[model samples]
Target: MEHPLPECPIARFLTVLDGPWATLIVRELLTGPKRFTELRAALPGISPKTLSSRLRRFVLIGLVTRTAYPEVPPRVEYRLTPAGTRLQVVFDAMAAWAEQDLPRTGSARGADR
Candidate 1:
């Protein structure tokens, strides 16, 4: 069911969350900071190009912070910002709902296919 635009806080949040990939990114980051390669490994289905783009967008939106270490190989890491961490409760609630309410699909709530 669709609700009126800009009228609800959740709707606005969803707008920022946007696409399927964004939520997945958020979910993964909930674990802790991770390098590009780590994220790529965790989300094997995501192409490098798309992951780069989403990380860029997340950085721009203040939901994520990218730190580049001045090392020989230039290691970079991504972590959620304070505002981003605020969504942990939301993620937890979703997990609870999925475990209690979703159909038993013989896998996780949002497991990669």
Candidate 2:
């Protein structure tokens, strides 16, 4: 069975950023443009395959841009588009909500066991 896309904004947001790595990838790119190797280094546990997949999706969805330069080594850089940068406000709101409503846990995820 096929399901129609959700009309709710939150659902649409989740439809785009569904996986655990999606938001994390955006967060990393939020700092500045980075190469494939640099992104892998910045995100310690992320597999190269996963990073590539996310970046590709981001580019397709107009959230990111991938620029390849003609150089001896073939340099490529990934940067957030203006729409992606707007997500910072969403992140900020999430942080504020979590600080006020969510319980304190040492771990970043803060998932209750």
Candidate 3:
């Protein structure tokens, strides 16, 4: 028989958002819906292949919706679903923590060598 799944809420949430580059992608989407190319431009460090994979995972988890428009060139846009929008509070709390409690080391304070 298969083992029962874990009951922790944090673990459950992370399972959906724990893939490589997932948080960065969600942060980008928090700004607004974007086309694939636009998201690539905004997140300069992510490769096209990785971005595609992350988008696929987000769709699977129902956090994002991809819409396609028929045009001379097919147009696709990614937007956060209702579930995703609700995560903004979590993101905001994280941001607030970073700003308020991050260590004020010399490097963090921008002290030059």
lDDT (Cα atoms) of all candidates against the true structure = 0.87, 0.86, 0.84
Candidate 1 runs further than 4 Å off: 1-7, 106-113
For this target, which candidate reaches the highest TM-score against the unseen true structure? 3
TM-score of 3: 0.83
* lDDT string, candidate 2, 1-112, tens digits: 1677789998989977897688888878889999999989888999999999889988988999999999989999999999999999988887787786674764445454
Predict model 3's lDDT versus the native: 0.84
TM-score of each: 0.82, 0.82, 0.83
Tens-digit lDDT track of model 3 for 9-36: 8888787678547887899899899999
| Candidate No. with top lDDT | 1
Which residue ranges in model 3 land beyond 4 Å of their true spot? 1-5, 103-113
Clashing residue pairs for model 3: none
Q: Rank the candidates by lDDT, best first.
A: 1, 2, 3
Candidate 2 stretches with Cα past 4 Å from truth are 1-4, 101-113
Candidate 2 least-lDDT 10 residues: 104-113
